[model samples]
Target: MMPLEPVVLSFGAVLLLGLGFGSGPCNIACLPYLGPVFVATGSGPRNAWRILLPFTAGRLTGYTLLGTGAGLLGLIVQEWIAAPWVRWLLGAATVVVALSLLWRRRHRGGGCVTDPASATPTRVAPPEIRMTNGVATGASPGATSGQAQALLPGGLFLMGAGMALNPCAPLTTVILAAATSGSASAGLLLGFGFGSGAVLVPTLVFALGVAHFGQQLTQHMNRWGSALEHASVGLLLLMGMGTALGWIAP
Candidate 1:
């Protein structure tokens, strides 16, 4: 078992780090994916709590699994590989991931566009929408019922997973390495803390607006969301490049 103190402290640090870094960019880039989840859950107090629970649960599961895997991998590397090589390899990998993100951004139109009326918007309609309507009759614009059903719980989970899977920095790997070398339980606990920290603020904001936030809510969210996505991509690219050049360690 992991020592309770270190595990708790590590978890707390990871959580705070995630919150500090994740709030602006992840929140913005992921709004479209999340908005429907909120909307589907009915945008009320009870629904917000219900969705938040499962969403947080899934996130916790993902992070714990990731941390555990990283911890195990670190153990293997520690046994077989030199520490310098590991750092270099991690740095190289970070750079590659960052470059990929940059290339994607360049090709995919530089993150999401904030303005709805702008040449491009951050969120686009899914390709499947092109197919002829089958399950439900096509309703007039601004209709809620059919749209709501389309944004089911399963769909929300998948989206959340996708959003979280984006290439992140060495934070998780570093934390896992520390914990696994010490204790597996500590690593898992730290993972939960990081996940919770990353999610707390947005979840709170979402909870607060469960009932109503008027038209401004959507508009403001869209604008900020786009900006956040752009920032995240840029940060990732810069960090990746720095790591690649040996200017920073993983």
Candidate 2:
């Protein structure tokens, strides 16, 4: 069996890049509006853990299934995947993600820069959540009030599942690289690692300080979010360049 550390390191870097600071579909930054719901319910910290755990679980479930399936396909044509040129291809891809972020910041003022990590997702929340008597609550078009609480888990899960929906080329590349290892389990392991990182940021945010520092946390995160984004991109560029230069080779 291949020593799995290098594979895991690659997946973690890519996953963090996607979730920690992005405007794309998989970025938890895209879901900042979620903080208010827990806050309004007066169970922000508790619910943050409960809902976010399952949200992360849903992501792992989807990624594992999809990655495992693709890995099986990859095994059928291992020669193609094993070609030395393939590593060069994957390395170039990592470089592209780094460059794309920089170019977007320079040219588009940080407009939506789609990458392989952006998943196709149905927006998790309703277009708008109606404040019911000062609390964030809502009902379906015809349903009675007080339904949001009953359905919050499902909503959170769906949102998390949405993260897995559109597999970007780069993400798919990562998965396929694992599949090329000739072990179907490699894809599953990588998926689990990636999904865990996806939830870690938002979970830590809501669980640690958001409950007590709702206004402050939001303000600070908003102010620091771009810096975090730029910082993560810089790290990504470094990670990619390191791989391209064989500095991170196993």
lDDT value, residue 83 of candidate 2: 45
Give the alpha carbon lDDT tens digit for every residue of 156-232 in model 2.
55444544533454455556566665456766666565655555665666665564453333233443434544664
Cα lDDT of model 1 by residue, 30-59, tens digit: 453344433311244444654556555555
Whole-structure CA lDDT of model 1: 0.46
Error of 2 at 3 (Å): 24
Q: Assess candidate 1 and give its TM-score to the true structure.
A: 0.47
Which residue runs does candidate 2 get wrong by more than 4 Å?
A: 1-28, 74-148, 168-170, 213-250
The pairs that clash in candidate 2 are 120-166
Model 1 misses residue 200 by how many Å? 0.8
